[model samples]
Each structure stands twice: as structure tokens, then as C-alpha cells.
Target: MIVTHEIPAIQTVDFTANTTYGDFRDDLVRDGYAVIKGAVSKEKAAHYVDRYHDYLEGFGLGYDRNDPSTVKEELLPVINEKGMLFHYSAIHEDFVWGMRAEPGVLKVFETIYDTEDLLVSFDAINVSFPNRKDITPNVPWPHQDQDPERPGFRCVQGLLNLLPNGDDDGGLLVLPGAHNISVEFHEQFKDEEQLYRWTNETYFFTDAGMKWLDTKGFKWVKVNADPGDLIIFLVEG
Candidate 1:
């Protein structure tokens, strides 16, 4: 049987006033991040997470690549049922599209980007595993999300926390103001392999070797939040 979820329609988040707008902007500018407390509503987030649990139970979970890939649209994860990958977007488009209209998200983006004409897109389920330690650090080997030769503008990344998160539980760890640094910095780090230094310069030069080089020159902050809490991080353009 194709399982179903009980999640209600996610309402449009409203930021109809300057005060509300400024509050979000300030938070983003000052912290390079903003949190929408209770953005998803615990009951709502759980409906989806429960589906993930059921799907994982029947089929299972596996990491697709840099991040885990579920069927992006429905929030269904690719489980590891005996060593196979799957993807499901069982999540509602409203939950995905409505994030753009989310008042908390809009305000923060407006404040940081200084543009009222902002649009946010739900990227993926971004299931942060249980406990804070179950998460991975956001450090990139160098432009992890984009190609090395072609520097692309970073669209803001919004994460829906489907579970409780803490510093110990694997919440996001962001590098403050690192977004403001030149892309050249990332490229430079990309070429240099720290492993080579430790191995007496015996690091073989290969695309795979550099893949493990993960470091960002900036202060990294861990944003702790609950299931309903959402995070918005403004990147280059």
C-alpha cells in the first residue's frame, strides 16, 4: 500500500510590516543566519518524519552523495534496504513552495539581502540524523555545492528540521561571514590538500584526493533548534 501522511496544508507565512521585516533582516546580517521558530509545527514535521521512518523500515536509508537524497518532492528518503537507493518526494508542494512565503524566512532574507522581492525554494528533506552528533559539518572541501571552475551564485539554503537538534545532536554548523569572502579563497583551499602535509607530501594529486580537503576560513556557529524550527542561510546572490 502506498502510505499517506496526515500533514495539514502549510499556511502562508506573513511579514506584512516593516517591524517584522527588519527583525529578520537584522538577524541574518548580524549572524549570517536566521531561525524560524515553530516554522513547520511539530505535529506537521512529525507526519513527514514518520513517513520517513515507515519508508525506511520497509525499504531503508542511504546517502546519495554530499548530502542524503530522498525523493526531493515528497520528502521520501532513499533507504538502504539490503543495499539499494530510493528517492521520494511525497512531501507537499505547499510545504516546499510555502517556505518562500514563510513570514519568518521572508523577513530574514529581506533584512539580510535588503530586498523585499525575495523568493525561497525548498531544496530537499535535508534529514539531519538523530542526536546532534549524527549530523555532518557544513564545511566544504571547496565550493561543494558547485563546480570548481564555474563559480555560481549560492542560493540561500533553507533547512526544515524534521527532528530535534542540538550541538550534540547534529544541527547545522555555519561559518559566519564566510559567505562574504572571495570564492578565490575556496578555490585556493581546494587545491591544497592538508593530508599531503601530514603524509610528508606523499599525497597523490587526484580529484578524489582533494575531495577530502574540507576547511573554511571563518568562525563556524552551530544553530540549535527543534523539529518545527527552520534555518535560513544567505549565500552569494
Candidate 2:
């Protein structure tokens, strides 16, 4: 498949003590994604990065965060029985859950829902390493994290960047304003043999689905964020 990606410039908002709820929600609703800058402290981000390496060592992978020499790219992606995710280790699990329950993060979601009641997703961390000569490029498969039964922005997906990402970095890609028509898009593909479905790991879009989204003017926007930043996107049906 000849896959091409468009990397459009994205705007990020710095979260301050005075940042308003509207600032976050407007970006999310209009762009289908929002980048919250400095959501975590630099010191904390450094700690998490170090902790990740320790977790990998504990899992027998023996990866050194600061030393690339320790990694065998092909033998990578060590996982536990609980599912091979970054947060699979007990240590990472606690760190990830703690991030989810952060007061600032919760406040943003609560304000969007206009209710104090909110549910946090048990999400796993995603780690994509550079491709080796023997490995194929891990291309982006644009898709919505939703099923036809559920419509509108029923759920939100988030990513907390532990490292800085550049334009060429393999990261989350999105289609701005696509969520606004998610219901209609799903209706168009209700009979598809394999409609995009949400999973704990990832979601996917079929060729037909991609073509349809393209026809509707949906284009991919690669996400770029610095350490301590957070990116959230709406998962509409």
C-alpha cells in the first residue's frame, strides 16, 4: 500500500493556574484534539521516564533508557501476561493510574461534561520504537475509537508525552473536525465487513472507510508534543 501522511501545524495551549475550561473544550470540539502543554512538571516527567526504564529491566528486557546500546529493536515489545503494554508492570500501573486521577486532568474532563461525575479509562501506554532494516514501517491506520451503536463524543482518549516529539516522530495522528460528523460517518459504514472498533490497544480503519473519510475532507494531522504535555481526542461513534 502506498501510504502518505500530512503533517499540519498544530496549536498547543499552556495549562496554567488561571486556564479556563472553555479553552480546553473549544479546542477539543473544534479540532477533535487538544494539546495541554506542561500538564505535568518537568521533574515528574523525568522521574517517569527513569521509572519506565526500571520497569523494563524488571520485566527481563534489561532496557536502559539512556543507552540505546542495550536495545535489540527486533527483540523489543516485551509484554507480560496481562497484555504487553507499557503500563503492564505493577510499577507503571500505579504511575499511569495516578496520572489519570490528577486534579487538573479531572477538572478538564469534569468541566467538559458539566458534571463532577466522571469515569477514567483504564488505558495502557503506547511505545513505538524506530523501525529496523528488517522491520516494516509502522504506518498510521486512521480510524475512530467507536462503534455504530454509540454516537457523538461518548468517550475521550488521552496521551501523556514522556518525551519530546518532532514532526517526523511516529505519534498520534488525527483528523480535525472529523468528530463533528462521526455519527454520519458511522452510518455510512454501518454495513462494512469490518468497521473500526475501539480496543484497549488500538483502533483501525479499512480502505473503504479511509476513502470515505477523505471524500468528506478529513486529513491526517500528526501530533507533536513535548515532555510533560498531554493530548486528548474525542472518540465519537
Candidate 3:
């Protein structure tokens, strides 16, 4: 069967700090990623879900059964048992813009990365399920947010939880301090073509390649946090 992906493309949000920017930046530096509890008001988080559905209604943009664009190309998403999305981020223009320019969200990055000139890479809205057994795990591997040539403080990714993240929900997991490690192994997975992996480790390289992660003492775990929390981590420069 032939497969295709039809999805709208847009940039991730770039926010400026209006409050709690200073405190959060420190947390980001200490931990690879920090979960900001209720980063957005319940009303705002709800907006994300609303805007998500709107994007679907307006553009007919959900993952087509025949075509895998929504999951493969957009976020490598895996639907959970409850029939809900684990990571879905095909957003409308309003949602993207408002999130990018979020004052509270951006403030933290500006201070920690120590640059007013921070930019966000386009990322997918993800939803990971708790206890969803991945016989073939497809976790998002450790990599910088920006391109290999320029991976670091200048470019970062922001993940904000619009919903509740209890123990049941498999929160995001980042390898602590793996940001400072070398990108040499990342070279193999560098190809933008490495998108679909329905079987193999969704986020792992070859054995030779994965050996690199072990060298640096890679640590992977769910990014635990309540709703309205956001996490920003630094990439290598």
C-alpha cells in the first residue's frame, strides 16, 4: 500500500520572559529539562487542545490512515490504548504564534542561554502514554534542537504540558548532561530522512552509534511535571 503525509508546516514559538524567567533558567541549566507546573493556566492549556482540534477541522490534518504524515513526518507519534494521541502538534497559526511569543515561557530561555537572540526549532506536539509497552521502543533520542553546524545556546526546544502529567502518563525523558557530549554519533542519524521506524528503537542509533551514549553515562527518564509546566534544555554550541 502506498503511503503519504499531508500536514501543515510552521515554526515553533519564540517567547520572551515576562515573569519567573530568572528562576526557571537556572533549573534548565541544572537539569537537562525542567517541568514547570501549570506553566500555562488551565484555560490556556485547554486552548492548546482546542486549537489542535481546530487545526484538524480547518485543514483536515489528522494522521491519515492510508498516509502516515501525521505521525511519521510530524512527531513519530504513537497512539495509546485509550485512543488518544501521545504526541500531536499540527497546530494552527494563532496557536503557534501565541506560544512562540509567550512572555513567561521565553523569559527563562533568554536568561539561561544568556542570549536575547534565541530561536526555537519547529517541534511536534507530543503525547506519551504511561505504561504503554513499546515492545519496540521509539523514544526520541538525545540530540540538539538545532542543526549540527550550529547546535547549542542559540537554538533550543520548548516542551510545555497542556494536560495533566500524573504517574500514569509517560512524561518526556531526556538524558541528563548528554547535551554536553559529542555529536559525533549523532552524525549517522543526521539525515533528515530518518523518520519512520515502526519496529526498531525509535530513538536509537546502531550499536556502534549507541555505544557513544553509554560513554557519556546517558540517563533517560520521563520528564515528570504537572500541567502548565515547560522545559527548555541547552544544546551544544
Candidate 4:
């Protein structure tokens, strides 16, 4: 039931504007995901991108930002097939922390929770490259990060795009409004065997589940964002 289709148009918002904060909130509630335009200035994003390259090249493993051949797994950090660099303390890097502390990034969560006091998750940075001949194709693992036992908007996930994410650029693909029916779906599949048993935080959808979503008229959408834009979505969605 892996539905392959053309990417949808970009959905943009202005979370930086006080006037559109409510509109952004409403969109997240209804659509399960929203992209905040220019969450960080283009210049800042480019700087962060440079920092990422520096971090990679700092390994001295022969990785070169200018050479694609140097992107060999043996010459780089332990990046997963999905191009997520979770090892080498990448999450605690200064550039990552700087992005987390960005005013625009913090304001969105503050407005959502109605509080300035908040904690952030040290998530992995994705550097997915297309048409790589060195490794297997990156497969899309469609799953909800929310545990069904304790569901209903437990957390919101944000992806700060440091690169140009066009319709063709591989990024996040979300099932719109599927969060509204998550509870029902989980209840129906409670007795089914879990694919990822090591962690209760992630629940991968089965083919039957995809069929169910299709029956409900839900379609997967590829979220597009420019450099410095932040795409936020519900963990339960």
C-alpha cells in the first residue's frame, strides 16, 4: 500500500507574525502539519549549513563537502540509511543548539503551549542525498512517533530545513488530517503485533492501516520548505 504520487504544492505560514499565529495554530490543528516560512533568516541557515559541513569534515575521515565521492560511509560518521546523523554527538553540536534557541523557533511552541517554559528534543539532523550509488535506496518508514496507549497530541515535532526542499527534493511526507482518526485506528489494531517492539514511542503503520487511511480519503503530502523555514507537525499524527 505504498502510494506513490506527485508531490503537492507547498503550504506556507507566517508564525513570526503575531497576527498570523492563530492562523498557523488553526492550520496545525486541522491539517496535522504546517510550515513556518523564514523561521531563521536565509543567512543564518546558510551559516548552519556551513557548520554542518564543518562538523562532517572535522571528522578528518576524508569527507569533503566539495566532492561527492568523499561521502562514502567509511569516510563519514555513522549515518543511517535515511541519512540521519544521530551518532558522534551531532545533536549536541553548537549549530543544532543555536537553531533550537532561535526566537522564531521558540515562539511557535510558546504560542502553541501558551507558555514560554519549554523543553526541546535532541533530534537527528537529516542530510539525505539523492541518487546515491553507494547505498540502498532510502525507504519511507511511515509511522507515528506517538504511543497509542498515551496519545492525543503528546508532542509536536519540528524540522528546521537548512536546504532548499522543493517538490522533488526528498523530505517528510505526512498523511493530512490523519491525526483526527489516530485513536480509532489504534483501537482497531490493538491486538496486532508491533513492528518496532524495542520502543513504545514509535508505531509503524501496516499496509492495512494505509488502506484504511485511503478509505477515509486521506492522501500523503510531501512538505516543501525553503532554507530557514521550519516544518512542524503533530507526533500523534
Q: How well is each residue in 49-124 modelled by candidate 4, as lDDT tens digits?
A: 9998998899899999999888788888888789888877789988889999999999888877778999888768
Off by over 4 Å in 1: 1-21, 57-86, 89-123, 128-154, 183-217
What lDDT tens digits, residue by residue, belong to model 2 across residues 93-151?
A: 76667667766677666766667887666546655555434444455556556644545
TM-score of model 2 vs. true structure: 0.76
Residue-level lDDT of model 1, residues 106-125, one tens digit each, is: 66556444579765443344
Give the alpha-carbon lDDT of every model.
Answer: 0.49, 0.65, 0.53, 0.83
The number of the candidate with the highest TM-score is 4
CA shift of 226, model 1, Å: 1.6
In what order do the candidates fall by TM-score, top score first? 4, 2, 3, 1
Candidate 3 at residue 131, lDDT? 42
TM-score of each: 0.50, 0.76, 0.57, 0.89
Weakest lDDT window of 10 consecutive positions for candidate 3 = 9-18
lDDT of 1 at 120: 47
Report the CA-based lDDT of candidate 1 relative to the real structure: 0.49
